[model samples]
Target chain A: ALAAPALAQANPEVRWRFQSSFPRNLDVLFGTAERIASRVAALTDNRFRISVFPAGEIVPGLQVLDAVQAGTIEAGHTASYWYIGKEPGFAFFTCMPFGLNTRQLTAWLRHGGGNQLGDQLFADYSIQAFPAGDTGAQMGGWFRNEIRSQQDVQGLKFRISGLAGQVFQRMGAAPTLIAPADIYPALERGTIDATEFTGPHDDERLGFFRVARFYYAPGWFEPAARLHMMTNKRAYDALPDAYKAAIQVACAEADSEMTSRYDHLNPIALRRLVAAGAQLRFFPREMMQAAWTANEALMADLAGQNPRFRALWDSYRPYRNELFQWFRVSENSYDNFAFPAAAAAAR
Target chain B: ALAAPALAQANPEVRWRFQSSFPRNLDVLFGTAERIASRVAALTDNRFRISVFPAGEIVPGLQVLDAVQAGTIEAGHTASYWYIGKEPGFAFFTCMPFGLNTRQLTAWLRHGGGNQLGDQLFADYSIQAFPAGDTGAQMGGWFRNEIRSQQDVQGLKFRISGLAGQVFQRMGAAPTLIAPADIYPALERGTIDATEFTGPHDDERLGFFRVARFYYAPGWFEPAARLHMMTNKRAYDALPDAYKAAIQVACAEADSEMTSRYDHLNPIALRRLVAAGAQLRFFPREMMQAAWTANEALMADLAGQNPRFRALWDSYRPYRNELFQWFRVSENSYDNFAFPAAAAAAR
Candidate 1:
């Protein structure tokens, strides 16, 4: 029950600019930023408000980290892997090719050793990072043609990013990086034969189905892509403890809510894509096996070349392996048996 | 950044007694209540504080809802299915036999109309409920002997609860409901041949592995058990909007953190169990298939008898079906391909 207290000093109102890496149209991804901002404001009784800006408004999407580092904005929401060019270890914070799924990644970051390792790395850039959202297990990509074997991957031009790009390269395919806005045009103009983006909801909005008739899954490249909210270190440190806790709470809420939104909307959008004649196909077994091989080799190479990458990899790989073991016993077993039965019953 | 401001009107200070359904020894489950209380206090700058009381402190574990409904406590943290005697529909809010996993359940509750349905049913008891924690995809019960086929279940005496009890009963097994504290002794004394509790972390604490060497999984009976933080409707409504928002933010944080903690701790505990000579086994295919049949039949029977249960079932079943379809293409596909490879490499 509420009891009136002696008058106290008012907490100062604070406002922040939060730049999002995703465009305004990709609501599920970009909207996570809005949700965090509003929830923070609500929890703080409007004393702390954040104004969200989509890509290219304040700065380009890919430059969010730089903006946050330079205090161009007080905070920014973007995936950590996009800055892999800066450090190979950055990819682990987002997603790796065939890395941990959404829940595993969340556990590692929140409970396992991931957050400490992440903060240590992010501190170098003068930023404090928090996981804000996740796009659970992405679709492989939309393909102009069905891939039947490893030979189908040879010399095929693809638009992909992160370590997955390197895996593709090892498979003798030409991998190119393209911004989300440009992916559709590249596919449409035959510049790229295949491209991976977010899952059904955002993919449908970009009209990838109209351009590429074959929608392939599952996206081994970025199994579960996590978005991060990075605040300028000085700005973050200056906040009162209550406001700091509010930010953490807001980010956790957004992280959970965004994944649920994707899980709910992806099914509906997928149905629409199928109705519109987008053929759904699984990546061929041979292709998957070959990609797995390439991923293993590439990870080995990176670990040998960069000690920092090796440090993170040593911790990440084992944690991931343990998670894989546990999931096999629990999640994978139940899902493998029950899901197919449910599908057959629905049919 | 924070700045000084002139003194303003004092906000009301509110306090609530938050009762937990779990004993203090079961830290992971009961600890969620403490986390929520502290986070809410932190977010509200100590203006709103909730003091958590463990099971049997203010009232017995199973009487949480009754306490909240009778206004004996302002709030409670417990499982909805624990009160299934009040309404079968309450089972859906917690979990069901062969039901949705944690992520799917979270999606349904947050985004796929489940929250509204849950609130509508909870309104009858003058309670407002929010999901506070989840033990993600529990392991199957520890068994004294290996189950190799459907025939093995025919005369088994099992300790289980909720709809799962009925399913076991239909399988020709003698099913009994026992309190958590009593399960270890019951199994040790040969009163029950087997029992399903939460999972490895909690199971190890209860020393189930000592009594039963054959640890079978996955727990189809209760895939993901969600704990609820229920507030008395009058008390909840009377709170200032900011405090209400604080409660919500606190609950969401607790929900995410608990599952992450379980995912992290279970693996360590499982490894410890295995080292101590526990033989981990998968439920035989024949046993799983039979239990699935029993689950379906029992669900149909409940829906046929209760309109409210039917209403929630109609919605939950379809949402689950759609989620299954999506997971089949995304999570299941990736896991099936990758987990085995990871396992082989680890070996």
Candidate 2:
């Protein structure tokens, strides 16, 4: 314990328990929690150790943030978007519908002062937060029936999480909050007409394609989803500087790992889902328009009610609008010509 | 499916089934497979889609190459190092003990003609391969007890995956093969005295710190572990040009996503781990030397036996040596002084 004495003299090791909102099945989210724990331990040399519990182990998955704030758990891994039920502004810390992609989200957090704003927001909840993982641009939820027009979305019962639900609900869909585990059964039993569970790999694993054959394209609701690691503010401030650095390094690493994993697995899983007789469908023009309008209205209401929401909306909306126009001009134009033609020639 | 008809006219929709040698639990590896499928689908519209299966669903986790070769699956995602058990030379394709980090491996593969060499070697197995994911440099392994001298490692049963197992075997440590799910239990039961799984995030999730208090540093065996996406040569070559292009683009995207994700998630995970009671332990001087020497011997054996391994060894060894010296002059020295004191102050 030669180094122990030195570590002890500098800072005392603190033991903590971290609860995760997602199950171990979603590696990016669950793995983020695991990654933070390891880095903190390494940096602090065992003086500080954190035990991680999967969603159901400590508290109900959805209640992780509340548990952390209440100090029932010292820390938590979840999406800031999940807390929108408590405050609509919380979604900005995670991501927004039809908003930034992974790169832009990171840029906003790291360079555009999003991190500072996020820290400030969490401070009110007695928590310290960091951007831990992003699921890039996600796909639209899977559907049991093909959505051919705006009318098709009316009265649709969909299982969607976070702020996306509010937007969908405004479009006249019954947006139900279903856990990832419960999604499969709900979709299977006709409890949900559509559901979104990340990209193809996860959707396929949960057998969404088995019961629901109509898979949709473009996850307009969750353009980029950011997962977070939140610690008790007091606990985080007590971390040794070395441990904090390690946590930073580890979170950065998690960002990379999560993106790469999604990039690789989503393709193969999509292919299988399609091959297994699941029909891939796209939202009609009218449907997309309606949803976007609904999303905007919901955001406006959220901002009107909360100052933090207003602050983030001021920055986020303009950035997204600018990005949307740019992507439409270049990426959309080039991809349309190159891909569809290429697909035809391949056949 | 309005877009599908146009896409079909340009390039026919092709479907592929990919089996992964990883569970979605290991996000980076499995996620790469997911990204490839999604990117290909987006590029080709609905014309090209690939479905993915986890390691155990179609076959055992480690037999990704066999499945690809047999054409039971069109493609697979796995670490090339996992196949060292089949051919000692395969380790260089994935990584070598004390070998290249992320940058060096990327340089070797993309610019240094390592990919060409990899293709030539995989040709014998009737496979086409691409670099899918990289876990940069890794931590050594979690040890149950502190390592004092070379003798401390002798006769120890260590659960290690990939080519590092060979190097440890040479050092008189009995290297055991344990699946990711099984690592914690193996370590807890004292069936293995040490184990390594990526960096902190993953190691922390497996709860290695709970049982093994002594966490070691510097993952010499896997400085950069690169995963590969392999396809049966015939299956790949038979694809239409457009499908081929889609696959290539998809692979490239997966490559980027895997690394980016790692960068994001690792930080917060580390801090949480530290607060959990895990102790960080560095390897003693003598043990490191023994392992390094053993690695050299293993490398020499592979070079002598496999021509492709020899080619890679010729190119990689020198590059690694040069990089090490460079890092020593820059990164290593700066980090050593900066980290410890900074860590102390933060504490």
Best by DockQ: 1
lDDT of 2 by residue, A19-91 (tens): 9898887765687688767655543334467898999898999898899899999888888878877777788
lDDT by residue (tens digit), candidate 1, B205-294: 999999988998889988889999999999999987778998999899888889999999999999999999999999988888888888
Native RMSD of candidate 1 (Å): 2.3
lDDT value, residue A1 of candidate 2:
6
Give the TM-score between model 2's chain B and the true chain B.
0.90
Task: Give all candidate RMSDs, comma-separated.
Answer: 2.3, 24.3
Scoring each candidate complex against the real one, what DockQ results? Answer: 0.64, 0.01
> What overall lDDT goes with each candidate model?
0.90, 0.70
Model 1 chain A lDDT-worst window of ten:
A1-10
